[model samples]
Target: MKLYNDTNAFGLVSRANHWISAFLFIGLIALGIYMHELPKSPEKFELYDLHKSLGIGLFVLMMLRLVWLKISPNPEQISHNRFEHILAHSVKGILYLAMIMMPISGWIMSNSGGHEVAFFNLFTLPNLVGENETVHEIAEGIHGTMGPLMILVIALHIAGALKHHLIYKDNTLKRMLGKK
Candidate 1:
């Protein structure tokens, strides 16, 4: 199995992170939406805890992806045109930015609200800010607004990938798979 990406395809590590992160992110979005409709109860708290924990995992994965993408550059461009290349690059940039910021905003919101997010119950993240209602409120707002935007960008990214796969009939999406 390939361990690194080439001009034509992604390697094992990148594919692993990409697929795992995608699944986790989908779960997170689903959980977030579900949790909103849930009544105040232990189950709701459990869902929140699960969502936060998985989010931390996704954040770490995104960080690693950024570093990996930098060091292990693709051999060639999959994008056929300047516009496709630019748009794809922009989408990826926004996706990474949103991924990094979402967890951070959630962390700030939790910390300011005096609610701790324990990662898989293994350990709790450090609270960087003091418990302040205003900070908590602001962070909540940022997190709330960012979620839909993230989803929108992700949807567009998926559409672009599908276009490459079904319409373009290229290896763009195949490169992300375990095998090309």
Candidate 2:
């Protein structure tokens, strides 16, 4: 597979980034939901730390992905319908926004709650804000709201890809899959 995008299809780098980010997002979302109800204990704390670490990892990966996109432009959308094209772009924009917002909000939430975000126990990340219950609550609310909403947005993204592949019989999904 090619490393850079052509006019018709995505390259290996884009496909790798997309698939890695997709799996990470899904794992983080599932972990977030599952660990929410765990009773307070060592295990819960461990899981929360894991979640924060993974979130930070995702943030770093996304920053790198953005840089990669700038250096290697993505393939054009294959949709012929203007509305479908617009909607596809809109959903993608929202996904990118969420990818950035979720991690920052989580970092703020952790810092404001007087918690250190340890990355896989390798090192601690710098605090973004001083301890403040109000800020903590607000950030918490944003993170909480974004998590569930992300599920819906991700569903829409996947559904759109499937629609293009199955219903429209286009190269939209194939391009992302690194196929011609």
* Model 1 per-residue lDDT tens digits across residues 1-180: 778877777788888988898888777877888898999999999989999999999999998988998978755658888998999999988877888888999999999999997899999998879899999999999988888777888999999999999999987787777545
Best by TM-score: 2
Tell me the tens digit of each residue's lDDT in model 2 across 1-180. 589877777888889889998998999999999899898999998999989988988898899889988988887778768998898899999989988999999999999999999899899988999999999999999999999999999999999999989998988888787666
* Candidate 1: stretches off by over 4 Å: none
User: Poorest 10 consecutive residues of model 2 by lDDT?
Assistant: 171-180
Best by lDDT: 2
C-alpha positional error of residue 80 in candidate 1 after TM-score superposition, expressed in Å: 2.3
| Local distance difference test scores for all models | 0.86, 0.90
Off by over 4 Å in 2: none
